[model samples]
Target: MRLERVKEILLQQVEKGKLFHAYILEGKNCDHLAGVFANAITPYPEDIVYVEPDGLSVKDKAVMELQNRLSMKPLEGSKTVAIIKEADTLTVWAQNRLLKTLEEPLGDSVIILLSKNIENLLSTIVSRCIVFTVDEETEITDLEKEAKLQARDIGEMLLRKEKFFTITKKLAPVLSDRDRAYAFLDALQEWYHKLIMVSMGIYEDDSLESHLLTKERLFSAIDHIEEARRELNRNFNVSYSIKNMLLKLL
Candidate 1:
């Protein structure tokens, strides 16, 4: 289901007092799931203590904060809600620490973890949660479509790298927009990773132009790929990020 729909359901469940103690919301629509929860929490501000997992000072520190907040009666009349984003990135100790609170949550307490990949989550945590696959099936569908389209485009470009550079030059219109530029570069970086995996026989042979991204490009710039993501997070210049990554290719 779409994030909007998921949010509606969550809101309804909350109203009915049937909200799960813990939820594992999974899918590519993570941003949407967050939007739903964000919107729902608005009317009941007093009850919810939303924490952006990354912003927490210590690893799993948000859990302690959440437990502390939920320890008391929930804001006079409202129930307590905690939403953690990119939850799969959480350390093992963090999940272990949260197990007890999740298992014996107060009637007024509810926790939701939003993630793209749940395999990284502890099995104990998974078992205690009502897992929801948001875009699981949709990912395969979208990936198939994306593979076909991007493969064809990249194949033509790889054959004539010079021309492709010319095409990318046209992106000047959006080079100034940090968000769009970051997105463009991120996609390129991810595509290169998939290409490396493809070369390693991790991907289907039938996948198009699996050989387009050279192994040199893969190994030499792996560090830059990570740094680019960090740069984007820090709100660095998008055009600069893309240019630096592209330099490694040259």
Candidate 2:
């Protein structure tokens, strides 16, 4: 979904006085956009509270603070809007606390949870709110387009449990070209990102590829790709590091 469309939806909901108690905004630039939405609705900073992660995770304390903020009347508006950035990093305890807050409505206060990876969120919490998915808007070049196809084939090969040698041989060409290799990695990440959305019921694509993205392994697949990226960034041998990643993934 585009940011403008999301804004339109929210505006319509507000106009109808039928706005939801909570919304899960999941996608690229979601946290920034959440701020935009909150600012648009509540000019007063006090009326728009933000609950962000403390260091590495959103602890239960932050969720409690959020609940406390919403308990009060709006400082200067008809409603309050609370935003939880990087909601995917919320701790289990925090999620439980948040779940409780969701069960009890606090005035017309709204909670907007921003998540780049929606799968990390509890399904129960997701069920309680409207979810908006926004894709990254970067334009793909022709080279990148071909890289995506190549990456898709590689991913399918991995899912089919192909022999490691065959998969590595296929990856050789991509790794030989630095640009194409990076583009291929990008494509792979995008594939898992979309499939995750599909599995999570945020996006719909009932293709064979979606079938390949079985819930059993789809959840942890991105971690492998991400580790490969980190290894490459650290000047690790491309072929060796990627092969190791593939081995672990298999």
Candidate 3:
């Protein structure tokens, strides 16, 4: 789910005094949002218990400690919130211990499991919690925005049948910063995805670029951008990948 949607749902739940006993925050980068949600649900720091894995897995000892803590009353607030960071790292034994607590949670106690990869978690445990997937686009930085705009301009130039050298020159600045290069590819991916959507009449946009490109070409663009992203992830030469992607896209 989108971050905004999750926030809205959380707000509504809070306002109605209907917050769930457990929630699983899952996404590539949802740690920050987990912290935010933790604070939002239980404003008092003393009432919020944070459980972080000390090794490859959340040890049984830690789970036992958490269970003991949860058994007590809230120190200062109406609720006691436990945020288990990297929840997917919970060992089988730890998970079983947690499952018992989740099965019969204390009144006004909330357990927030934050995991980047939910597949590692037990299905039964997952079933007990409301899940929210954080959208990475929600945390776009200023640098990423600039890179995205530059990438869109490059796409527009390619659609205009501009010279390859000119387009390559336009991407020189992005090549210097690895983060910007990845960000540019991400932006290109989004751009082509939107174009594909527009072509299918599933989305409405005023961009003439989308109207001008054929569905086949838009699909090809998305493929090339995704390939570039993979190359970047593999530590390929930035300039070469960008040039190759532009050549294929054009």
Candidate 4:
């Protein structure tokens, strides 16, 4: 969903007094999105509390501290907004403790949890909150979906050791346009992210691409594609740069 659209939806809930006690926002720009949502819901600065991990993880102490602060009456707005950045970094013990807060929410208070990936969070935590997965642009996401299909087809061809001419034939449309080439690269990046998640055992994908790529290989591929994209931005020949990227991948 677009950020503005999600904001509107939440605002509607607020207007109707049907606001959810908690929300789980997961996406690449979720941190910024959460900040914007927090401000939109609670304009009063004093009523908003932002909690982030100081070290590797948010432990029991941090959750307890948040609870203590939340216990106090709001000084301004009727509702206090609490945003937990990197909620995935919360320790298992901390999540258990935080679960109590979710189960029995403070009256008229709202909690927003921001995470790049919801796979890292406990099932119970996710189940309690309304989840929203968002992208920066709905238009770009549609393009990415189309570009992603092209990428997958080419990937399958490469894995099959198809002739360069055959693969290049498949790349004709993507390489013909600079914007399409960039979108193609962006689609590969999406795959790279999934590969990382697969490596972490937090996500499952039965695609051949998942079985064919190692994290190191995927990272190197991303680097090559990004360099080619930089070249394209520098006014390099679109077809040549994209074809060169394919060569490097092969």
TM-score of each: 0.49, 0.55, 0.55, 0.55
User: Ten residues in a row with the worst lDDT in model 3?
Assistant: 195-204
Per residue, candidate 2 scores C-alpha lDDT tens digits across 1-250 of 4678666766655555665678888787876678777776677887888888899999999898888878888988888999898999999999999989877777679899999876677755765566676756766579778977877788778877899999988888776666666677667766765566455554445664445556547646666766677677677777776787788767
lDDT tens per residue, model 1, 1-250 = 4456556656765455455567778876676665566446445667766666565422577777778888987774566677777888777778887787876878767787887776667655755565555644334454344444443454335435545366457556435676555445434544554455455443333654535556555544444555665677688877776556555454
Model 4: pairs clashing at backbone N, Cα or C within 3 Å: none
Error of 4 at 164 (Å): 47
The C-alpha local distance difference test score for the whole of candidate 4 amounts to 0.75
- Residue 48, candidate 1: Cα error in Å is 1.8
Deviation from truth (RMSD, Å), model 3: 11.5
Ranking by lDDT: 3, 4, 2, 1
Model 3: per-residue Cα lDDT over 1-250, one tens digit each: 4787667666666666666678888887777777777787778999999899996878889999999999999899888889998999999999999999988988879898999866577756765666665667667679777976896798789888899988888888887778888778767765665565455444446874344577556655665766777688788998888888888877
Which residue pairs come into collision in candidate 2? none
For model 2 the TM-score comes to: 0.55
